[model samples]
Target: MGNKKNLFTLAYAKKFLNKKGLELFKKSNQTRSSNSFKSLSYTVLSSLILIIIFFSSPIINNFKNNLITQSIEVTNNSKNKLENVLTGKAIENEQNDKLDILQIFEDIFQYEDKSTSTVRLSASTIEQLFKDTKYNLKDVRKNKL
Candidate 1:
């Protein structure tokens, strides 16, 4: 009786598996093949892009070098023409104009007098000053003040 029951169970299991399990396995295999094909295509695309960039790099570099050389030549020619056009008096006047501009900036930014004193406060003094106020260092830092 046990042998018959076991055989019946085995037969039912085999039938159930044959109906659903085979389809599941076939679908999984198809998905795996599709995933592999996608990966292969991505790899080929990336390799082609890399190959294109590699082949074009020299051309890009040569173009950049030519632009740089042309700019340098242009600047050199401009400098030569400027030097030829400017006499000694004009060069001296240009230098004087540069000095006057520097002087103006210095005059705008310079302190009025060296007699003005800067008071140095210690950390304890700073803390004491803030202790009376509503704002503490932490609050000030948090508020970005």
Candidate 2:
């Protein structure tokens, strides 16, 4: 019984992978390569078709335009909503509340008034700082390029 089983196994192996079966396996491999090439070509062709459809289609252009217009509308809506909230709250409050809200927004947004602070530099102050350097104004005035 064991010998029969072994013989069956050997016969099965020879049917599929022996020298004569090797030629058949090689032919199948060739066909598989050709099949893979065909699939690759189909993939490239489909991708190119999709790209052409995406670019040349008016429906796609309209979709893109709609997306852009919708985004702009959304931004405008948000700005209007913010302004409405600020104005609506300010109208309900006293005059002090309006100043407080403005101050709060200025603090949050860091909108400092630059005109209130002035920096004045004297010529002697600048000359004293550059006394050790050749870039002093007196030296600079005498310098010729």
Q: Which prediction has the highest TM-score against the true structure? A: 1
Worst 10 residues of 1 by lDDT: 88-97
Clashing pairs in 1: none
lDDT of each: 0.72, 0.69
CA deviation > 4 Å runs, candidate 2 = 1-52, 55-58, 66-110, 113-118, 122-145
Model 2 clashing residue pairs (backbone): none
Clash tally for model 2: 0
The TM-scores of all predictions, comma-separated, are 0.30, 0.25
Candidate no. 2 TM-score: 0.25
Q: Tell me, what's the RMSD of every candidate?
A: 14.1, 17.5
